[model samples]
Target: MNPIQQFVRWEAEKPEAIFLQQPLAGVWKKWTYRQAGQEIRSMATALAERGLPPRSRVGILSKNCAHWIMADLAIWMAGHISVPLYPTFTGNTIAQILEHSETKILFVGKLDTWEDQKAGIPTGVACIGFSTYLKTPFPAWEDLVTTHPPLKEFASWTADELATLKYTSGTTGNPKGVMLNFGAFQFVMKEGLNAIDVKPGDNNRLFSYLPLSHVAERSLVEMTALYSASTIYFSESLETFGANLAEAQPTIFLAVPRIWAKFREKILEAMPQPKLDKLLKIPLVNLLVKRAIKKKLGLAKCKWVISGAAPVAPELLRWFQKLDIIIRDTYGMTENLAFSHINLNKVKIGTVGHVWPGIQWRLSEQGELQMKHPGLMMGYYKDEALTNTVLTNDGYLKTGDKGEVDREGFFTITGRIKDQFKTDKGKFVDPTPIEMQLLQNPDIDQACVVGMGIPQPIALINLSAAGKSKSKDAIRDSIAQTLEHVNPSLESYEKLEAAVIMQRDWTVENGMLTPSMKLKRNELEKANLEKYPVWYKMKTAVVWE
Candidate 1:
């Protein structure tokens, strides 16, 4: 059954059961299945009254919230296609997507940057804001729901019908709208749940904080909750994220690599790594230490702790494993709804893991990974020519990633084919591996290896909070040690000439990072390209920007 049908079944079977929990101020406001169903139905009815054409594109611009999911369901119930925009998108991007998708109406919910983003909503398109978030000039959701009766008859869709347009994060260029159908959701939800062994139960708790526009969070958290009849908890704000997570103690958790690193930094701040290691060596003390740490991170009850969106450092994975927190690494893309590969019970430290069921994969001559699956997107919206470049005639999606498979069928993403840069020495350098090595240093938060026309590659790094707190001499020593350790393992052409410490951090607000926290390599290069030659010629192994 599709997610909408499954949601309806749960609403009928367990009307009083709590399905969503949203935190306001310090307290959590909850919605039972029946209450949520009523809101969805009422909103659906209100949408139908707007005289929009059939299958109209409706936009959702909000962070993860109960209203966001309700709005999506309401759009689907009203026989419209849902288009989700990342909460962190800039005004220009937001306007571009709304105009490109030809969105009829947009549901604006909780956002930290609403003031700047509001201008992006085109004048012709109507908007409705969630009562709890912003007080916009447009109509409010509460008013609409109170005025309209619940939609008695929900819209039914065929498996092949288009459901939602999930736009890409746009690391390299303008974001493309991925056309996902009901069948794609059905395939991924069914196979994905079975693969992860998730059982339907109200007791199963999930935390939804990542951008739901991203395929990983949409499929894993939102769709998984609907299929499994799980209770989902929403984070209040960034300031209270830790407390909210500890309160929820979700059974399933998903985070990108950067988040995992931040979590590590937080733990280390409370208890130094040396002391942690010393305590873990004790027999009974180790168990208590592990339990306490897990409880603090709100993963004490997490059955499946997953890391995706970008390649996680194996060093970080091994560090967590020592505390009995085994974080599974997953690999996939927006085009496939993130149904490519995942580490199940047995995990290979560096590799993403075995290929997921019903996925066929092969490597191109240039080492680009290609995969064909039933869950693949219909194609990019309004850009058939661009879509044809990625989706081959043979039905395989050119992943734009270079990867290798081990004998046991485990997969390791080597680098992005587009990210490879040629040096002045006439050698192509893959920056991903070198950047991954740079990340092994706890002092480094973000790393980008760029050479371009330089004689040799030089790494540009942003210091972590811990690194920033330390003395410059100490930070330099630590980074030098890491380079010393990593350089020996690299080929002569790929060896780094120096490490340049960036004066500023790369953040989503700065446009150096995508909303998913992956580096916008192209943007990073554009900002720092002119400094490469000077940095490469530095006498010191580590150069301060």
Candidate 2:
């Protein structure tokens, strides 16, 4: 099945179906399947008219929008590879990705700021605007679609032909362009569609806000739409995410662990823990409580909810499940198409669920997960050495994640192999599990455990808003009490001795977290490790930073 061709099929089969929606000037603009198809075809024709040869690389730097998806399809239709850049990327990083991919043309779509993005567009590299901010000299999206007739036929890609060059979020190192072919996308999309039933006449809706540059969001929001014909809605901004989600009542909601944590915090804020616990125990009130909570959280219509991109605490999973909300944990990297293992019906809470039926996976001697699958990408763009380092000669992709697979086939990611640190005592410690345990406390929003050449590991805890609002003594007491409970359970080597309660938030702007919301351990270490000795010298269970 050609993933791109699905748009053509759907347009003919369901011409008037609502295909896309975007918030414009406090109102939602809608597009039918046929209309979307015509615009995509028109965009493709315009690119061809600009003298772009097939197999050329085109960059798309934009946030989640109807035009972003349309541009992606148009690039594929024109037989060129699409390279997607995160909207949050700096000008330098944007230039790096575009230059590295050898992008010949770019499609500028909906974004908050175009100054930095436009500055990154290399001289002589053409850019076409899809929104108002990107204007003047270059052609505009509305003008092209209205002026140029839709191409009657688009270039058909063979299964093995390249479709996109996906750039990794790069928590460990620099981002690498993962060359994904039509076959890789088709394999996972088909396998996923087969595994999960998109019940007919369900009128499914998809809410997409996460960076589509990430493979997880791309697979769930874009590729899933191709397979299921789900109507897609784009979030306006962080301020209106709640109202947007409520309006859509999306059947499928995909998010990262950070968003899920925020939702849990919001729910707790509305109904305090004690009150929620009491209300959940009543016989008839329990059902009403669950329904009311779901509606309040805008998940009343959700049938499939997935949390991925990084490991989520098992406690978070359990908390949601108590309300009859199922959040499936999935595992995949840009090396593959992000649909390797998924927690389906029979889920083991802490694990990332069973491997796909047709895929092959195993744990290496060092407990690193390796995959041999049809969904794997071709290689890194223009970096054979880098690709060789990750891809095995025998066809296995070294996942770099240290994990364990249970006899039941559930996979649990413990931490990144590089994240393991050796203490001065010569014992290795994986901080992810400890960090996850620390995050269970409502007071702590983010936690990082580091012990490089230190006697014992130390935790750096970033406080929640509520925690920040609390008195300093109260914050210290809460963290100390949490550590008191957590310390006794772990071995001496892995236990965190002293905790530093950080006043600052760990965010993308500060470089403590990747755009995908995964913690950047190296950056965190570089920024905070020198203070460890001072904290430990205080001889207190917790120290404020």
Candidate 3:
């Protein structure tokens, strides 16, 4: 069955169970499965009455909320494909996605910064603001629900019908819309629910903080609610994230690796060496410490804590372990609806989880990981050339990530094929694993290693808040010693020549990070080429900041 069918079933099974909990104006508001279903049906009737053609694109621009999911379901129920637009995307990017997908209806949420760009939306298309807090001159969201009765005479839907058209986070180039069918989404949701061991009617509370525009958060998260009947809470704002977490007390938690690192840093920063030592020394105090840590992270009640979107540091995993939190690292992409592999039972510290159930994986001679899954996208929307390049004749999707499966069938992602660089001797060097290791040091916030045409790999790192307070020489010494602990397993060529600490972070606005938070290596090299001489030639680690 497709996502909506499952959602419909859940509504029937648990009508009074809260499906969505939105934190608005410092208060938590709930929408039950029945209420959600009714709202979606009403909205669907309104859209159908407005004459949205079958398979017509219905785009949604917002963060994670009840309205976002409601609009998504309403579009699907109306026999239309839902296209989610990133809240942080530029007007040009949003316009490109809308035009590329030929979207005719848009549901805009509360975005104060995007008010001016609303005029850039296609002239003939319809746009509505869903949240009352939004001061836009656009029509209200309540109008959609109040205007029409539930569309009982709905058109038939098939597994082959297009369900969602998700655009990639434009990093390497222009974002392409990923066209997913009903079969693709159902397959992903099924496999994902199995891997995560989500039981229907289970008391799994999820906090919806990640942007729903991304398929990772949309499919794996929102769809799971249908399967698990979990209560999803939305965050008020970035500033209120911590407060929201404490309030949500979620049982299922998912976040990007950078956020996990920040959480670790927050705990360490709060209780430094002496205090930590004292806390650990007393057994009772240690128990209280662990509970306090969990409470602070809003993960005190978390039964399933999953981290993805980027490689998580093994050290961060151990830190979570100390607090009795089991963190499972998963690997997937937008093209596959983000359910490729999940490491849950057999936790591989340095690797992503085993290949997702019902998914087939193979590595090419060049070690590029390729996969075939029922959930894989049909093709890039209206881009046959790009589709042919990615989807092979055998139906295996080129993942671009270089990986290896161990004898036990556990998969270890080495690095991106595009990320691997050649040294002076023409030997390829993979730095992701090493970079992931360095990020675990608690003193290093972020690290990117570059060695193109150099004799050996060199690294540029951003120090953690604690490391920022240290003397340059002291920080350099600590990093060198940390490297010494991790370098024995590395090959001579893969070893670092020197490490330089960068003063600033590589952010999206600065063109150093992608929208998904992956480092833009080419951008970094271009921006820092002039400063390379001090590190590459010195043969010694130095902190530039």
Best by TM-score: 1
lDDT of each: 0.92, 0.85, 0.82
What tens digits encode model 3's per-residue C-alpha lDDT throughout 3-78?
7777888888889988998888888888999998888999888888777668889899887778988888888888
lDDT of 1: 0.92
In candidate 1, what are the lDDT values of residues 1-545, reduced to their tens digit? 77779889999998888889999988899999899999999999999999999999999999999999999999999999999999999889999999999999999988889999988988899999997877887799989998999999888899888999999998899999999999999999888888888987637899999999999999998899899899999998899999999999999999999888999999999999899999999999999999999999999999999999998888899999999999999998899989998998689989999888888889999989999988999999999999999999999999999988889988888999999999999999999988888888878888999889798888999998889999999988999999899999999999988999999899999999999998999998888888888887776799999
lDDT, candidate 2, residue 473? Answer: 89
Q: Give the top-scoring candidate (lDDT).
A: 1
Clashing residue pairs, backbone N/CA/C < 3 A, model 3: 343-353
Q: Please list the residue runs of candidate 2 whose C-alpha ends up more than 4 Å from where it truly belongs after superposition.
A: 132-137, 199-201
Cand. 2 Cα-lDDT: 0.85
Per-residue lDDT value at 17 in model 1? 84
Flag regions of model 3 displaced more than 4 Å.
115-120, 453-455, 483-489, 530-535, 538-540, 543-545
Model 3 poorest 10 in a row by lDDT = 110-119
* Residue 362 miss distance in model 2 (angstroms): 1.2
Question: CA shift at 431, candidate 1, in angstroms?
Answer: 0.7
Task: Provide the RMSD of all predictions against the true structure, rounded to 1 decimal.
Answer: 1.0, 1.6, 2.2
